[model samples]
Target: MTSHRRPSSPRLGLAALACGAGLALGGCHAERIVADSYPTTVAQRHPIVLAEGSTRLDLPVGAGAQGLTSRQKEDVRAFAADWRKNGRGPIGMMAPAGAFGATAVRSALASAGVPATQIVSQRYTPAGPEEIGLVKLGYVKLKAQVSHACGLWPDDLGSGGGDLYGATENREYWNFGCANQQNLAAQVADPEDIARPRAEAPIYAARRQTIIEKHREGGDTTTGYRQADAVVSDVAKE
Candidate 1:
């Protein structure tokens, strides 16, 4: 995580920080220099944030449909696909009472790999007449999530407030760049990737054998990149 910088304001006739001295203000704004120099809390620099948490796929239960609507059915199917790939453990079903489209949910669940014999059920209450109910498919898979709302200002910036002493010192006030961390966490599609690298893909034996055979027949091993699909990067090799 990186700290965001606010624009630096001149000291207004005060000493202008030296051009390149270690003690001088860097290219960072004036507030950044102070915030970096003296922070009131560790959270200002390195905050502990949740990388993963419990999340649910909420599917709307429509009323009088007597089952999932076409859109809802497609949604269930999509959830099923994801669950099969990344779900951590057993899938639990949360069914509202008299839920519509019970059969469709069951069918979709079965299609996704849940056995009919092992299907679990629960009672739920419907919120409206047009609504049949909702079926929840949950698994405690390797999900990475973040805490809700962090990096709030620790000290008040008002004049004559209890934290007035904070102003005299070059200390970073609370609530700096908390939203940036939260935003970064939200961009993570898989929390596991944040903590560790992904697993390597399996080799294609058939393709490897073909290449080996071609090499044995005195063919050129080097192949040109596909111009249409090639991805070029300038990153230095480790």
Candidate 2:
């Protein structure tokens, strides 16, 4: 008996090609998903976190000292000014039991425009003889800071590690841009400025009026300044 070979099915060949193409596309898609799992942007990796925090000041008082000295009073005043600007709750003043500087702290805080109701006094037992006259002042306030701590190296920078392929991908390392984020957080004056925009400041009425008057009279709207030697010396000419 003579046997004939079965002809190859065109449909089976097309189906094999289709499955191979599908596998290739699926591999690329899986790689994209894996790459996106890590934070790509600096802000995403090290975000500026707004949270509640406290500010503290420590003042050392001698056993024989009377009230706060002039310098201490100034320091307390500056601290209170900062509290008034950003602090939320009462300003707390803590001292060793039987310490003599509580009255002085209250007086300085009052002089700095802090109301008596806004100041809270507490006393603590001294840890040692050296802490007898130490007075501490603190208040709760809103703070802006980086979420991640600086100086952390989670990955290797060399070519012989697990991150060797990652280095070739031209992406930022884990700790890149952390210092810039930290500095930016430290420079933020108001945490609210990061969350929302401030209200517009009042316009300079006098300057606006002057400019409008000059425009109405067909005069130069641009400001002219009369320079004087007393105001600005012409160092180049001299």
Candidate 3:
């Protein structure tokens, strides 16, 4: 003989309903409960600087490449000229020696509005003495001092990311969710999920503000200025 248990009574159903209602109410309360509050304007307190005199830009070259093509060189020169005309100061660029050499950068600076006299190129040999080893060595360095009095470099420096200036400006670095959130903040966008708020929002806002302030104060160190170009490049690709 087979015996079966009876179904749960209406009382049980009523209890479940009550529990669900309590949970929903609790959630609403939680959302309304404002936790410890701090100043909201911390992020906004920082100012942004857009241009400055004479900045260094770095470009990386792939291995085994020759040099920048004539057209590419022209493009760089034009960019430099524009930056100069716009009060960006002196514009300099660096790249690997082989194909994307200093000549290409010089051309770009010329195109960008810089006169040929203002363009300067140098070769950077690797630091260590493993000269004949398997490691490749040969890099082209370019430097331009911005002729105008502007703060573009400092502002760009503090913004973080690998910029054209080749500086690592991101201070509150993180992984996974936080990293994503910080990246979003860099773009000044609303983040999409909870992890971002919990892990990234506060720090990113603080860092951004700091960078802005530094720019405003005329912070000239390349500490934050170096990676602007690269960051811009990656963002463009994305």
- Indicate which candidate wins on TM-score: 2
lDDT per residue as tens, model 1, 1-238 = 9999987667632345343343454452434343334456645454434432443665555433466667877777777677666666566677776656566678877876777755566767767765645667665656443343564555557644635446667555556656666666667677667666898999999889888998999997776686664445634442
Error of 3 at 42 (Å): 6.9
Top candidate when judged by lDDT against the true structure: 2
Q: Tell me the tens digit of each residue's lDDT in model 3 across 1-238.
A: 9999999999999968877887887732323233333223322222222222343334443434346666656545555544543432333343333434455455545555567665444445544443311112121222222223222232343455424223332232111133333343445322222123445445588667878888999995345445544677788899
Model 2 ranges with Cα > 4 A deviation: 1-34, 62-64, 164-169, 225-238
Which candidate would rank higher by TM-score, 2 or 3? 2
TM-score of each: 0.52, 0.75, 0.27
Output the worst ten-in-a-row residue range by lDDT, candidate 1: 28-37
| Candidate 1, superposed: residue stretches over 4 Å from native | 1-52, 57-66, 98-100, 117-119, 125-132, 146-148, 158-173, 199-238
User: Which residue segments of model 3 deviate by more than 4 Å?
Assistant: 1-37, 40-67, 74-78, 85-87, 93-100, 127-238
Candidate 2 local lDDT, 136-235, one digit each (tens): 8999999888886987877777644746546667777888899998898889999888778899999999999999999999999997799865534566
RMSD of 1: 15.7
